[model samples]
Target: MALELIKGNTAVAEAAMRAGLVSYFGYPITPQTELLEHLSARMPELGRAFVQAESELGAINMVYGAACTGLRTMTSSSSPGVSLMQEGISYISGTELPAVIVDVVRGGPGLGNIAPSQADYTQIVHGGGHGEYHLIVLAPASVQEAVDLTGMAFDLAEKYRMVVCLLLDGFLGQMMEPVVMPDFQPVRTTPPEWAVGSPDSKERVVLTSINIDPPNQEQFNVKMMTRWEEVEKNEVRYKGYYLDDAEYVVIGYGTAGRIALTAVRAAREQGHKIGLLRPISLSPFPTRAVDELADRVKGFLVVEMSNGQMLDDVVSIAARRVPVDFYGRMGGMVPYPDEIANAIIEMIQGEHDVNADGRAKWLAKMRELVGTGE
Candidate 1:
């Protein structure tokens, strides 16, 4: 395995091309434009179709059309641009299309900035697009993880007959790091019988979410829930470091997870029993794994680039089982490991400020600042 220094965004594009993706439809957006640019320039040599769509919506619709043909396809954009594609994403999810969407998240709510942010946690992980559906969301912390997981996204999307998204942020996408490319192997995709261009196709297939009849819509929703349950069971991925004899666990994902790992190492040197729990899969959110950790650890500390969106998942899993502390930086601010280490030390020494209501009052103050009212 030869390693080369590459930015995370470029790695994703390279992986897609190497993995036999012949169709690329995307619109230019900050932090992720390099990916589209990379594919646009390189894909033509492979005789692949690369289009710079007029808008995010147009780009996703192109993906929809190509995916309906049962060929490997992909699209990418940042948070705001991804928001534009949600309606199309929901339709794609409803029809069980096999496609990959890369979301290099920036600060949000509206054209926030061109900085790294984990603010899309609630949107991507909680089914951002309106519908009774979920997209398999993978969060990668490094350039290597970004490339490797983008390849996995395509595989999982084909296997599940659904959409899969690689969720990273500007930091991971823009920062250069050493990445080893996987061996070039052909992508093997077995399209379902219901797919439009399948061999046995004898009639046109309609892919839409519009089931106007109430009872039929209810039935479809139930079926979707069943699939989600299976996803929860089999698809959760996380990495546990230094957890063997730890008293506190630090939970994070994407770039924040890497920071948390550094903090864990620092705490170990200081003789603090802190470990790191890094979620690789964000949607099928490794909740049960987190709950299991509660049995051993005294508490869980949730850290993120946003104001505790992922922390909510941690709190849900840790409820009544163990104490969960939350720390976050908002508006696209990134935190250093020293800050995380300090927070862990404070928690270990029982130095966190708890309100009279026994709630972490800082959480309430943070929500107030973010105006989330949580």
Candidate 2:
């Protein structure tokens, strides 16, 4: 198949259209602005609905309405813009609305900058809104990855009857690379039997999470937990590099993982045994994969562009079975491969203290949460 060089944001928009999204509602934000612009110019020719919503909140609600009518819908934004959509995302999760959200992340505590950052990992995977629900978050490390994952996200969203988030960073969104888009298709949707407002309302039903009864809320939590377990069982996804006989592993996701690969290569050349564990699905988290590596590796160094949010999972998974250390560069800063290589070398050489006890306590807590308490 022939490939065309395209920017990540443009590739994502093209892939979304090729995947047959008929309704798009979004507010433009840096890094992802090109995607919306592309869609705005092209979707009309395909007879689709594309709205530059008044606000992120309005955009998400528009998606909710379109999704309720059984259309494949999408929205794109950066970190601060995404924050505004949280309430709508939460509501959609409670109602099990099938939609795809693209977050080309920029730095943030609040509108920090328009540079790439993985600071939103905690928010995306651990529920950014006021609920006990999880979005299936996919981290794309490159332009092609961004495109491919966008298509996969829409499919998974419909199949699971859930919200799916494509978590990319500004670097990936702006970088240009060759990609082969899938053949275009007309939009087709089969509303879940449980979807609300169908003509056969007496036979089917509408359900929301706004439970007034205490038992009902408890039941909702239990039900959502069950769904999450099912997701972990079937959907935890990751990629490993240079892991054979390594004494230490470097863990990362999204664009950070792409940069970490360079460190892995350099470390290997220096005769330092280091591996990379890159999780594609942040929500399901690829926990078991990390656990398997934990039994083999002596230690792990988690590197990210945030204040160690994902490092928590690495610590919990490795437990006392191995040492775990964290390193990060926040506020849109990205660590160079040399820096990461040095960190891995330090971890393996025992130059820095690794938290075995903290890892042990975290493991116990995770075990309790997952009902596998040891």
Pairs in clash, predicted candidate 1: none
Model 2 agreement with the true structure over 1-374: per-residue lDDT tens digits: 89999999999999999999988999989989999999999889888899999999999999988777666899999999999999999998888778999998888898699998888888888888996888999998888888888889998888777899999988899999998878886677545456565654458665565788989888987887898789889988889998888788899898788888999999899888788989999888988888998887788888788878898888777776787876676778787888778777767876434445433433454355445534
- Model 1: runs farther than 4 Å from truth? 187-192, 351-360, 363-374
In order, what lDDT does every prediction score? 0.85, 0.84
**For residues 1-374, could you state the per-residue lDDT of candidate 1 as single tens digits?**
78899988899999998877969999999999999999999889777799999999999999998888778899999999998999889999887788999999998668899999999888888877886899899999899988889779888988787899999999998999999987765853544567775766678666777899999998998988898888888899988899888889999998999998998898999888888889999989888879889777777788899868887777777765776777788777898898888778767876333222113544675566566644
The list of candidate 2 runs beyond 4 A from truth reads 189-193, 196-207, 351-374
